[model samples]
Target chain A: MATFIDGFLWYFALAVFVIGVSGNLVTIILASRKVDLSVPRDSAFSGALRTLFSRFLPDQHMLSRIGIQVVAGYMFHLGLFILLFFAAPHVAFLEENILGFGWTAAPHWLFIVASQFAFLGIIMLWLYRMTNSVSRLISKLDDHVATILTFLVMLSGCLALLESFETLRLLHRFLVELLLIYFPFSRLMHAFTFVPSRLFTGAWFGRRGVDS
Target chain B: MSERLERGLSKLRSQIDPKVKSFFSSCVHCGICAESCLFFTETRDPRYTPIYKTEPLRKVWQQEYTFWGKLASKLGIAAPIAEQDLADWEELVYDGCSMCGRCSMVCPMGIDIAQIIFKVKTGLSAAGFSPPDLAETTQRAVDIGSPMGVKLPALQAQIGHIEEEINLKIPVDVEGSEYMALLSSMEIMYFPEYISALAKIFHQAGVSWTLCSDAFEATNSGLQIGNTEVAGVLVERIVAGAEKLKVKNVISPECGHAYTAIRWEGPNFIGRPYSFKVVHILELLDELLQSGRLKTTGKESSRLTFHDPCSIVRRGGVETQPRHILNAIAENAVEMTEHGAMNWCCGGGGGVSGNERAEPLKLKVFNRKKSQLEELDVETIVTSCSNCRLVIEDGLEANDMEINIVGLTEMLADHLVVDNSQ
Candidate 1:
C-alpha cells in the first residue's frame, strides 16, 4: 500500500509539474512572440540574450525595488521546497521512483516551524497586495484565486503535519492535488511566465532602438 | 475643440474599462505607494501621492457606480467633478509623474499602479483634461508636421540655409537612398544643427539616406498627448512615408518616446509590423563602428554622466546602449546610481513637454535629478532623447546649475567626418 501510494504521488507530481511549468512557459513565449518580425535586424541576438537575463534575473538595479519582497519571496519558496521535497512522503517517492538519493529529512519540529514561517511570509505578501494600489489595480481574478488556493494548500498541509491522522493527511493531499491542477491555469504560473515575459519585453524594446 | 478631438472623445468611452466596478469599490486608504512616486518624493505633499493622483477617475467610477456614491454625488451631498480637481491632478498624473512602473516594480503584491494610471490618463485625455502643452503641441504637429510648429517650407528654408553654409544638398529624399532617416521634431526645430550633423555623418559613412519632407517629424505627439487617435494617424503617416520611399532600412533618431512610438509602440499600434527594419541612431552608429564604416576622432568631456529619459529607460528598457554610445564618444562616462531602467525622469517626458502650466511643477519634481547631477559631480549631462535634453536643461537652469543638456546625435554628429564630396 505504501509503494502504491508513493507511486501515485510521484506520477501525479511529474504530470502536474510538466503541464503547469510548460503551459505557463508557452504563454510567456507567445506574449513575446507577438512582436513585429521586422524589428530584429537592428539588434544582435546576443544583446537580446544579455538584456533578457539582466532585466529578469537578480540585477543590482532591481535590488532596491524588490528589497523586502525578494527576501520574503525567497524565504517562503525555500521553506516550501524543504517541506515539499524533504518531507518523508516526498523522499519515499524520490528514492523509489526518481533521484534515488537519500538525504536526512528535516525533523518534525523544524518542519512545523518552517511551515509556519512560509505561512507568515504568504500572509505578508497578501497584506502587501491588499494595501498597495498598484498591486491591487494590476492583479487579475486568477492572481487572487491562486494566492488563496496556495495559502489553503499550505495551511492544510501544516494542519496535516500537526496531526497523526491518515484522513487529515489525505485531506492535505487532496488540497495539494487541486492546487497542482489549478497551477497551470492560474497566475501561479508566474514562475514560468516571469522569465519569458522579461525576455520578450527586453528583446522587443532593445530591438526597436529604445536602448539609449 | 477640433473636429478630430470631437471624434476622439466619443470613441474613447467604448474602450475596455475592464475593472471599473471593483477598482473603485475595493480601496481602503492604504498608502503603500507613497515613496513609489518620483513626484511624491520630490514634493512631499500628501495630495500628490500615487494613490491620491488616481482618485479623480476613481471618484468618477464611484459617483457613476456605487449606490451611495451615485446618490450622494447626484444629490450634491458630495462634491462633483470640478475644473480645480482636473488642474490640481494634471501634474499628479502627467507632469509631476513619470509612470516609471517603479511603484509597480516595488509593489509586494504586484498590483501595477502604473497601468491604472495610464488608463486614467487615457480617460482624462478623452474628457479634454489633457494639459494645454500636449494639446497645443499635437495641434502644431498635425498642422506644421512637427510639434514645435516648424512648417515644411520653413524647415526646407532652414535646411537650404544650412546647405549654403555647409554646401551639401543634405539629401532630402534622394530617390535611390537605402535608408529613410527619421528626425525627432526637436532636432528639426530648435536644434537644426543635429539634423545637419546626421547629414554629415551619413555623408561620411557613404550611406544613401534621405529625410522625408512629408513625414519629417518622427516625434509622435500621440504618445505624449495620451491620444491614440492622433498617435494612430501620425503612425499611419510614418508607415505611408516608409512605403512610399520603399527603403530597406529606416534610421530612427535618438529620441526616447519617438523610438518607443515608432519602433515599439508603432508596430503594436499599427497592428502589423513594417516590412522595413527600424534602427535607432545608436544601433546604426554601433553598426557603423562595428563595420569600420565610420569613426569618431575627438573625446567628449570627462566626468560626463548620462541622464536616462523615462520613455527610453523605464518604458523602453533602453538603459545600456546610451551608456555604450556615450562611452564610445566620451573620455569618462559616469552612470548615476539610479541609471538605466531604475533611473528617474527628466520631467519633460510623456505629454509634459509642451505644457507651460506644468513648467514650475516640472522643475519642482525635477529637483531630484538636480540632486543626482550634483552627486555625480559631472559638468555635462549627455542624454539620448531630445525632450530629455530640453527638460534637463530647464531643470538645471531652474536650480542654478550650469550643465549642457546634449542629445546623442548632437554629440555624435559633432565628431562627424563630414563628407564634403557633395
Candidate 2:
C-alpha cells in the first residue's frame, strides 16, 4: 500500500496535473484570435508588462473598499509560494525527486510563520466566499471543492511537520496528490492563467491609450 | 431545446474568444467587482454584480467549451443554458447595468467586465429578450433616421432656429469640407444650444465644418441595444455621408456613447476603416486651442465641477481633453472624489436612460453620483455627455438638490473669445 501510494499514485497525479494544465491552456489559446483593425494609441507589450506587476498593488482609491481581499489574498498566495518551494522538507523532496537541485530551505521559525499565514488567509478567504453575497451568488461547486481541497492539503502538510511518523507523511502526500489531480479542472487554474488574462486585458486597454 | 434558446446559446458560444476563456479561467470569484458596480453598491444586491451579470454567457462557455462541462452536459448532469435563464437575466444585463466599465478597472484579474456584459447583451438581443423599450428604440433607429424619430425636416427646422438665432449658416451637405459633424438626437430635440454652441465656436475659429443632412444623428441605438447588424447599418450611414461629402474629419458631438460608437467601435462594426478620421468634439476643440485658433475669454465665477462621462473618459480615451476645456473656462474647478477615467457612472448610460422600466433603478443608483456631489458641495455640475447631463438633471430634481447642470460644449462656447480679426 505504501509503495503504491508513494510511487504509482504520486506519478499518476503528477502526469494528470501536467497534461491537464497544458491541455487546458492550449485549448484556451486556440479558442479564437481576435484582430483589432482599429488604430492603437499605445504599445500593447509595455502595457502587458506593466499590468503583470502593477495589479499586485490595489489602486489607492479602491484600497478602502477591497482591503480585506487584498490583504488575505496576498498573504495566502505569498505564503503558499514560500512554503511550496522553500520549506525544508519540500526543498529536500524537490531536490531528490523532482528538480534534482534545490535552494536553501527557510528557517524553522519562518516555516511556522508562513504556514500560519497560509492557513489564516485561506480560511478567511474561503469563509468570505461562502458568506459574501456576491461570491455566494457567483461561486459554483468547483470553487468550493478547490478551496476545501486546498485546506485539506495545507492541514495535512502541517500534521506532517514533525516527519517522525511515516503515516503522517503519507497522509500529506495523499492530500497533495488529490490536489494535483484536481488543480487543472478547478478554479485553481487561476494561479497560472492570471498572467495571460491580465496581459490580454492590458493589451486591449493599452491599444485604446487607457492604462487599465 | 427551444429555437430561441439555441440561438442565444450559439451567439454566446461564438463570443467565447480567447480573451473570454482567459477571463473565466482567471476569475477567482473574489467579488471585488461587486464593490465597483454602482448597482451593487447602491442596492447591496448580488445579482447586480458585474461578473454575476454574465452568468448566461459564462454558462454557455462552460457547457459548450470546457471538458468537464461537456461531459456533464452529455450525461444530463449539467443543465444547458435555457430560455428561462436568458429571460431571468434580461433585467440584470439591461436595466441593472450601465456597462460603465468601473468594475473592469477594479478587477484584480484585469477582466473587462463591461466588455463581457456587452457580449452577454449580444446573446440577450439575439434571444429577443431585450427590453421592449430598447427594442422599439433600436427598430426606430434602424427604420427612421434617429432613435428619437427626428427626421431630416426636424433637423432642418432646428438648424433653421440655430441659424436665425446665431446668424450663422449652419452649413449642411457642403462637399469638400474640412469636417463633417454629427449630432445626437438629444442635442437636436432637447438641447439645440449644443448646435448653436458649435456654430459659434466654429465661426470664431474659422474652421470649415458642415452638418451632414444625410447622417446628422450620432447616437446608434443599435450599439445601445447590442445588435451588431443594426449598429453596422447605422455606421454605414455615416460612412456613406462622409464619403459623399469627402470630408477630412467627422466630429462626434458631446454625447458619450455616440463618441464611442463612432470613434472606437465604428470601424469594427462596418468591417473597414473610415475614409474620414473620427474625432470627438472635445478632441477637436482641444486641438484648436493648442493651435491658438480657439481662444476663451473670462472664466466663470461660480464653483463648478466636471462629471466625466463613462464612455468618453473611461472607454473612449478622451480623459484629458475635457479637463483642458474645463480648466480653460472655469474660474474655480473642483473634481469629485472619484473623477476622470475612474469616475462613477451617472447610472443612465448603456441604454438605461432610454429604458422607461429602468427609471426607478436608475434613480436609485444615481445615489452614487448624489453622494459624490454632496461631498463636494458644489452648485453647478459641468459634463460633456448630453445623456449624462439629462440623467444627472433628472436625478438632482428627484432628490430636490438645487444643483445646476450644464454641458461643457455650451459652457465653452459661452466663453469663446470674439475674434474680430477672423
Candidate 3:
C-alpha cells in the first residue's frame, strides 16, 4: 500500500495536475478576446505588468475597508508559498521526485512558523467567508471545498512533521496528492489565474490611462 | 428554456471571451468588492455585491465552460439558467449598479467587475428583461436623433437662443473647422447654458469649432441600454459627421457616458480607428489653459467641491484635468474624502437616471454621496458630466440639502479672461 501510494499514486496526481492545468490554460488562450481598436492613451503592456505586481497591496481607499481579507489573504498565500517550496519535506520530495536537483531547505523552525501561519490564515478566511453576508452569498461549494481541502493537507503535513511515524507521512502524502489532482479543477487555480486576470484588467484600465 | 432565455444565454456565452474566462477563474469570491461598491455599501444588500451582479454570466460560464460544470450539466445535476434568472438580474445590473468601476479598482484578483456587469447587462438587455423606461428612451434615441427627443430643430432653436444671448455664432456644419463639438440631449434641453458656455469659451480662446447638424446629439442611449449594435450605429453617425466636416478633433460634451462612448469606446464600437481624434471638453479646456490660450481672471469665493464623475474621471481617465480647471476657478475648492479616481458615483450614471423604475433605489444609494458631501460641508459642487450634475441636484433636493451644483465647463466659462480681440 505504501509503495503504491508513494509511487503510482504520486506520479498519477502529478500527471493529472500538469495536464489539467495546461488544458485549462489552453482553453483560456483559445477563447479569443475582441481586438481593442480604440486609440490607447498609455502603454497597455506596462499597465499589465504594473497591475500583476501592484495588486499585491490594496490601495489606500480599499485597505481600511478590506483589512481582514488583505491581511488574511496575504498570510495564507505567503505562508503556503513558503511551505510549498521551502519546507524541508517538500524540498526533499521535489528534489527526489520532480526537480532532480536539491537546494537547501528552510530550517525546521521556519517550517513550523509557516505552517502555523497557513493554518491560522486559512481558518480566519473561511470563518470570514462563512460569516460575512457578501462573502457568504457569493461563495460557492467550490470555495469551502478548496479551503477545507487545503486545511486538511496542511494539518496532515504538520502531523507528519515528526518524521518517525511512517503512517503519518503516508497520510500527508495521500492528502497532498488529492490536493494536487484537485488543484486545476477547483478555485485553487487562482494561484495561476490571478496573473492573467490582473494583466487583462490592468491593460483595459491602462489603455484608458487609469492607474488601476 | 424559453426562447428569450436561450437567446440571452447565447449572448452571455458569446461574451465569455478570454478576459472573462480569466477573470472568472481567478475570482475566489472573497467578497472584498462589496465594500468598494456604492450599491452594496449603501444598501448593505448582499445581492448588490459587484461580483454577485455577474451571476447570470457566471452561471452560463460555469455550466458551459468548466469541466465539472459540463459534467454536472450533462448529468442533469446542475440547474439550467431560466428566464427568471434574467428577469431577477435586470434590476441588479441595471438599477443597483452604476457601472462605476470602483469595484474593479479594488478587486484583489483585478477582475473588472463593472465590465463583467456590463456583459451581464448585455444578456439581460437581449433577453428583453430591461426596464421599460430605458427601452423607450433607447428607442427614442434611435428614432429621434436624441434620447430626450431633442431633434435638429430643437438644437437649432437652442443654438439661436444661445447665439442671441452670447452674441456669437455657434457654427453649424462648417467644413474645414479644426474641431467639431457634440452635446448631450440633457445639456441642450435642460441646460442650454452649457451651449452658451461652450460658445463663450471657444470664442475667448479663438478655437475653430463647429456643431454637426446631423450628429449634434452625443448622449448614447444605446450604451446606456447595453445594446452594442445601437451604440455602434450612434457612433457611426458621429463618425460620418466628423469625416464629412473633415474636423481634426471631435469634442465630447460635458456628459459622462457620452465621453466614454465617443472618446474611448467609440472606435471599438465601430470596429475602426477614428479619422478624427475624440477629446473630452475638460481635456480641451486643460490644453487651452496649458497653452496660454484660455486664462481665468478671478476665482469663485464660495467653498466648492469637485464631484468626479465616474465615467469621465475613473473609467474615462480624465482625473487631473478637472482638478486643474477647478483649482483655477475656485479659491477654496475642497475634495471629498474619496475624490478623483476612487470617487463614488452619484447613483445616476449608467442609465439609472433614465430608468424611472430605479428612482427609489437610486435615491436610496445617494446616501453614499450625501455622506461624502456632509463630510466636507461644501456650499457648491462642480462636476463635468451633465447627468451627474442633474442626479446630484436631484439627490440634494430629495435629501433637503441646500447645496449648489454646476457644470465644470459652465463654471470655467464664467472665469474666462474675456478676449476683447474677438
B1-422 per-residue lDDT for model 1 (tens digits): 45434433343333324233323333323344556566767776656566666666666655554445677787988776664565566666887666666654433333345656766677667767777778888877777778877777877887887888766678776665689888876777767887777777777788888888778778887777677667877887887887888788777777878877886678766678787777777777767767878787787766788887766666665566666667778988888887776677776666666778778778888877888888888888888777788878778877889777777777877875544455
Of the candidates shown, which would achieve the greatest lDDT relative to the real structure? 3
**Of 2 and 3, the candidate ranking higher by lDDT:** 3
Interface RMSD of each: 8.7, 1.4, 1.2
| Candidate with best DockQ | 3
DockQ of 1: 0.08
Report the Cα lDDT for residue B175, model 3: 98
Instruction: Give candidate 1 misplaced runs (Cα > 4 Å).
Output: A1-38, A41-66, A84-86, A89-106, A123-160, A163-212, B1-37, B40-93, B99-129, B310-325, B416-422
Q: Which ten residues in a row have the lowest lDDT in candidate 2 chain A?
A: A30-39
lDDT of 2 by residue, B1-422 (tens): 88988888878888888889889989998999999999999999889999999998888878877777999999999966779999999999999999899988878888888999999999999989999999998999989979999999999998898899888889999999999999999999999999999999999888999999899999999898889889999999999999999999999999999988988898999898777788899999999888989989999889889999999988878889888988898889999988887899999999999999999999999999999999999989999999999999999999999999999999999998886664
- lDDT of candidate 3 over B1-422, digit per residue (tens): 78888889888998988889888989999998999988898889999999999999999998888888999999999988889989999999999999899999889898999999989988998889898999999998889878888889888888888899888999999999999999999999888999999899898888999999999889898888889889999999999999999999999998999999988888889999998888999999999998989989899999889999999989988999988988888899998988888999999999999999899999999999999999999999998888998899899999999999999999999998876766
TM-score of 3: 0.98
Cα error, candidate 1, residue A28 (Å): 9.3
Candidate 3: where are CA atoms >4 Å away? none
Candidate 2, DockQ to 2 decimals? Answer: 0.74
Native contacts, share recovered per candidate:
0.07, 0.74, 0.87
Q: Which residue pairs in model 3 clash with each other?
A: none
Return the candidate ranking by DockQ, descending: 3, 2, 1
